[model samples]
Target: MAETRTFDVVVLGGGSGGYATALRAAQLGLTVALVEEGKLGGTCLHRGCIPTKALLHAAEVADAARESETFGVRATFDGIDMAALAAYKDGVVAGLYKGLQGLVSARGITLVEGHGKLVSPDTVEVGGERYTGRNVVLATGSYSRTLPGIEIGGRVITSEQALELDYVPRSALVLGGGVIGVEFASVWRSFGADVQVVEALDHLVPAEDLAVSKALERAFRKRGIGFTLGDRFASVAETDSGVRMTLESGKTLDAEVLLVAVGRGPRTAGLGFEEQGVRLDRGFVVVDERLHTGVGNVYATGDIVPGLQLAHRGFAQGIYVAEQIAGLEPAPIDESGIPRVTYSDPEVASVGLTEQAARERFGDDAVETLDYNLAGNGRSKILATQGFVKLVRRKDGPVVGVHLVGARVGELVGEAQLIVNWEAHPEDVAALVHAHPTQNEALGEAHLALAGKPLHAHN
Candidate 1:
């Protein structure tokens, strides 16, 4: 026996994207149903962003204790307690999950707890019951990806297993030097593990500005983290003690754990997406500027849609889709304006074009750049952090990009995003007063240097 219920919007996948879509649609006075096979808040809350950051914070605490003498604080460097650390991370996630549940419930959005499959463009079936909507949103999210012929089990693991480890390995070999790989490497190194990273690209965090990537590499090397760049992975074998990885260069590296952090693939197969006329390009939903799937009243958001794959990006897309469904005609998202932050030892944050990208788009001669060293910032000196704020702009026009690397630099991205998104000129930003001895002042100083004032920097 199957029952049919209809709503104004039926969102599949109760992750950041789907839940956000449901929340905003409900707020706009549209009836909504949110389906999930797992808990609400999805990977970002449970497996990806939230839990990983907790681990990183614990790692920071460990590093602080180990380096307390540098700050004139007498403290003993102790080992990590796996049980306590897990409990703390789990506690943080539990609190957020509870809060999200309450918010969804309060919004009067129907929360369907089951595996949902799109039986048609406007209808999803869960446990033989069909939930139909005037419009449907696909936000199935993504799963951890691994190289071909490489198995993830026993000593070989993914980020999910890495998060649930009961003991810290003496050594770890992380494949992929992107955000996930570098982050786990940072955490393990802080927890007293020797880490080696493998990247098929020339630089770590290769998608970032070349300057930021090079700075991060220097920082990692200074911290004793070894890496093999420009080499691809060939095969991995389970050893008696741990695992052994052989690179394409025929170099063999043995470690207590092999973390396959290549990337994530969209979770869009066997879910009736194509059957419902939704076009998928290499497992990602193909959508227009407004997120329409070119299908009947169907829209897709989040990792499945294949742009940034960030949880925050998913949130924004979900809100946009909801507004569009409500006929609010919200403006399309400027993908370049979205902020990106990598939460590692020396955090990397950026918005808008990179120097290379700006040069390619606006020409090298048309762009001017400035690097404001954190060495000159009062707050950076206080924290003993090393990095810089790199700004790229039109020769005499507006700031086109903002890239930052150093401790707690990710926190400064909100203002950086605003500066780039609003197309603020270096002169305009330079005129603003920033609080003295704050990290944000670094941004001001960078803008000042770019505006030809050269405060705290050589011209």
Candidate 2:
């Protein structure tokens, strides 16, 4: 005889999406049980987003100290204590994890710590305990993917190890110049590392607009960071002093460390989706418009599902699924409404379509763009930032996109997302008064220019 724990909802993985689902479901008066093999808050809170951002902030502070002379202050610093920095980062992540645990507990969600796999359509096995649920949600999250023969080790590292390193290396090579790669490269470059970015693509951040990619290339070049765009890494060999990576371009880059920032993949293996008849698509758990799989009463969300792999996006999806289960007609999630932000020195953010994509879909004449340089803005001038705000609109339709590249531009993503999701027109925003000399004013001015009413900007 075995003990059977039953619930209205059983969320597997307990990561951002799972925990959020459990909490929201519990709040909706449904009994929820969350099963997790690792820590409660998942990668974003423990290892991925939270810790990496904190370490990057520390690197940014060190860089700021070096530039203090420009502000008429002589700010000197000793070398960065990597161990102490790791401890501080750990404390920050731990505190957030505690807070998440408190929330889950307060919501009356049962926390089950163990590895879980689907036993049946509405049943999961955790630590040899079979639990049945009225509904099941999968939120296993993802892991760092590496290239073949590129094993992660002491010198050959991934972003995971890069975050826990004892000290910043003097020289390093970052493989993959995507969001994560550029972010770490920016951090190391600011910390005085001779950082080189090896991107197989022809440009950095290949997903962004060509103009934005060129802007970052120019910005990195001005800052002395090296780039080997359109080059691929053949292999990594460790030497007595450091590690060396042979590039497909017949060149070898030697550095104290090599950080692999290729990308992440869903944690779908060994979870028994195949055995349970839960459909999968290209290694990710497949879900329909309702986020339900073939398995009756079973659902999935977050990185495991086939969509954008953002923590906030995962949060929204989880809450929506819970509300839907509670018989609430929560509006379907629009993936385009999710904003993407790269926290490099000059952050890049985009919501909705790109200029090229918009033109292709709506024809050349139907698409309009307003590129407003940051130098003309009072807020950017105060920070000495170089970049612009780009507004993309259909000639006769609503505004469709907002792309940005500049200092602190990531903060503008909230408004950009709202405009894109709400289908707000340029005139709609331009008509509204924006506070003067603020970063948001730059957006408003760009919108005004797009609406054919140029104000405080060159036409």
Specify the highest-TM-score model's number: 1
Screening candidate 1 with a backbone cut-off below 3 angstroms (N, C-alpha, C), the clashing residue pairs are: none
Task: Write model 2 residue lDDT over 34-105, tens digit each, in one string.
Answer: 999999989889878888788778877786787778768899866687788888899999899999989988
TM-score result, candidate 1: 0.99
Summing lDDT over every window of 10 consecutive residues in candidate 2, give the lowest-scoring window: 450-459
* Runs off by more than 4 Å, candidate 2: none
Candidate 1 whole-model C-alpha lDDT, 0 to 1: 0.95
TM-score per candidate, chains pooled: 0.99, 0.97
Error of 2 at 153 (Å): 1.2
**Taking the tens digit of each residue's C-alpha lDDT, what string does model 1 give over 1-459?**
567999999999999999999999999999999999999999999999999999999999999999999989999877999999999999999999999999999999999999999999999999999999999999999999998989889999999999999999999999999999999999999999999999999999999999999999999999999999999999999889899999999999999999999999999999999998899999999999999999999999999987898999999999999999999999999999999999999999999999999999999899999898999989999999999999999999999999999999999999999999999999999999999989999999889888889756534
Candidate 1: segments with Cα more than 4 A from true spot: none
Cα misplacement distance, residue 389 of candidate 2 (Å):
0.5
lDDT per prediction?
0.95, 0.88
- Total backbone clashes of candidate 2, pairs 3 or more residues apart or in separate chains: 1
